[model samples]
Target: MFEWLRVFWQGRIFFLARGDQLPRFLNQALKDGVVLYHTQKSERGMRAQIKLADFRCLRRAARQTHTRVHIVAKYGWPFVAARWWRRKGLLTGFVIIAMALTVLSQLVLSISVSGNRNVISSDVLERAEKLGLKTWAYSKNLDLNQIAKALQEQLPDAAWIGIERNGTDIKIKISEKIRPSIPKEAGNLVASHAGLIKEIMVIQGNPQVHEGETVRAGQVLITQALNPSLPSKTTAPNSAVNNAVARGFVRGRVWYSAEKQILLVEDKVEESGRVATGWGIKFGSRVIMVTTQNSPFEQTNKEVTSPFLQPWRNWSFPVEVIRVNYKELHNVHLERSVVEARQLAEQAARTEVQSKITPMVQIVEENVKVLPSNSGAERVRVEVETYEDLAVYANP
Candidate 1:
């Protein structure tokens, strides 16, 4: 074996011969750059492993010498196995990881909603869940368009809906229907409060009063219908009566006021109010608390019911919380200061009476009467009474 190694060490060209001619071939072979090695008689043929260039040279020499040669041992099984494993080792692990990630993403874990105003996120998520899209273990074969169509069919109030996937995450975009504004008519309504008439806008009919006109309640501050067409309907029955068409924008003095009662002594009142943290998160069967216990109001115990999907139907998942703590609070009245009381009373009286009357009239006068109540507390009661001449135009 060592001799065979030395014979082929110096980039030697070796020719393998048939077993029968092994000894004869080895004897005639030269020990130069070109050498010959022959195996003993065995079951398998004598195989040759050589560089392509050397193999060509040996073949040509054998042909010139009229010697028949057979090549064997081109590639051994162990060497071929090692080469195959080396080529595939790195890529095998990568392919396995990719397959695992694909399988995991096939199920929906989370859903996000966007572009919604009137519609709440909870509603969108719930509906999305109902449409077979919110399961933690979900099917990647979900048809987005079908899901959207199903949502619209289920929620008619949703103006538009769309669903898409970002890897394992899902996004649902929705837009709520916007109600159209009702058509306004001139002389429909106006502010009767005693404020300098800042501006008067007439949409449907002509303005009865100008921009800076001080008018009284029931006064024709603006007129959608006019009296000029009345005479034509009686005298000339077939004539066209051009009454101011009552169809436009009517805006005038609008005042807002609120008067609240409070004790002279500041008492610590147990005021219960809902303080929404505006933050909430759901994980599995539990919901982590996001709000702190420092809220000024006592929060009533509430059982929050969240829905989880089981491929198609919803399972009730509720979160129950115990009372944490209570904080001392006082009810602070709005516009209840001594200085603001009088003005608030007057404004309140004016708005209360004006809200009940037609906008065609304005509050020309205002009187706030403050009195004492039986509670031994100073009570401020306002009587806002105003008179305006409203023209009742007959329809032609």
Candidate 2:
């Protein structure tokens, strides 16, 4: 008990002493007025603790007695204070911020939203404020995710709604679904892309390019003005074609290319099996405890669900449970050889080029070119040729 008390009052060091003169070493330490406690014999040598104040005197005693000392551990508040005092600024700032958030979290400070084009921001705020999410209201029990979902349902144009909280501020982001566009009607058959004219089966139009001629994008391959001076064999089998909209198939050989760069070094992140679950209660527009707490993991993936029924469709129920689950993630870096990088780049290039062509179109010829690389990435470009219908509306 005295040893423990002495250690608390002052600071102590645990050390091991080795040499043939162990007994002489202790005698000299005591004669030198050095304090020692918890003395015991171990496999290495005699072990003991001395006051940090006596540490310098003990070293002198060891050298005079030809005994070597090895420090095993340090104890007491002085060492602890010294270690933490270096980070005093960071610790003080963290405490101040934490206290400020604690007081502000109980009251609603600000509510702001963005990305709403057709839906007015005031309408969204009005709906949320009515649902118990407003300025100066209790924010401790309000599930922002639920509020976002409810507000999204009220706005017909919104495709998705995401809500985030920063201290006392709540922010809402919205994404609207895209509307389709109507294409103009076909007037004269024109080349859809730059290609070599392969075959033209004109139904009611004048042949503007020969079979071996090259045409630019949007160039008229067939016109409605069927000139009599043009070659008769190029026209479809009929008496004489009228000025009706030109309709027929014009096959052309076109080339499409795509380039992709693959990195030799990559970082892959995955769950590390450590999880933290935070719990909270939601009553009306306030959320408490769980949702207000920060995640424990440095890097984590959060999964949360709200138990409250929203006010969408003119219905309202503001009480529910909330659980925020966090999963820890660890990153693993991988390095690949040049050969592997080139293979990945080629696959990516092929996938990208396929998106530029129609589903039924078959690649007639394919070529791959790789630039010489001495760094960590490989660049590959893939070019493909295809023969398909090149006719499109010749809009003026």
User: What is the Cα-based lDDT of residue 206 in candidate 2?
Assistant: 72
List residue ranges in candidate 1 displaced over 4 A: 1-95, 180-396
Model 2 misses residue 163 by how many Å? 40
TM-score for each predicted model, relative to the true structure:
0.27, 0.41
1-396, model 2: which lDDT tens digit per residue? 997776677988899999889989999999999978889998899999988998999877788878999999999988988877898998799899999878777787998988877668898889989878898887778888788768765553455678877777878787653322213323566676788878888777677888978887777776665456656676663423423556566777989999999889989999999988888877777878555387888889988776554567877566678887888988978799989999999999999998777544656899999977658899999999998667665443
Question: Per-residue CA lDDT of candidate 1, range 1-396, in tens?
Answer: 876554444333233455455444444444224433443444553444454334555554454455567644343344555566887966688789999888887877778888776567897678777767776746656888898878865553354578878877888887544322223322233333343344555544556666666654434444555547376556443222445444322234533333333333343444454433322445555556556534444433333433332233565434434233333344554334554654554565556665555433345545565665444233455443434222222122
Task: Kindly state the number of residue pairs that clash in model 1.
Answer: 15
Q: Pick the candidate with the highest lDDT.
A: 2
Q: Which stretches of candidate 2 lie over 4 Å from their true place?
A: 1-186, 225-243, 267-296, 301-329, 394-396
lDDT of 1: 0.50
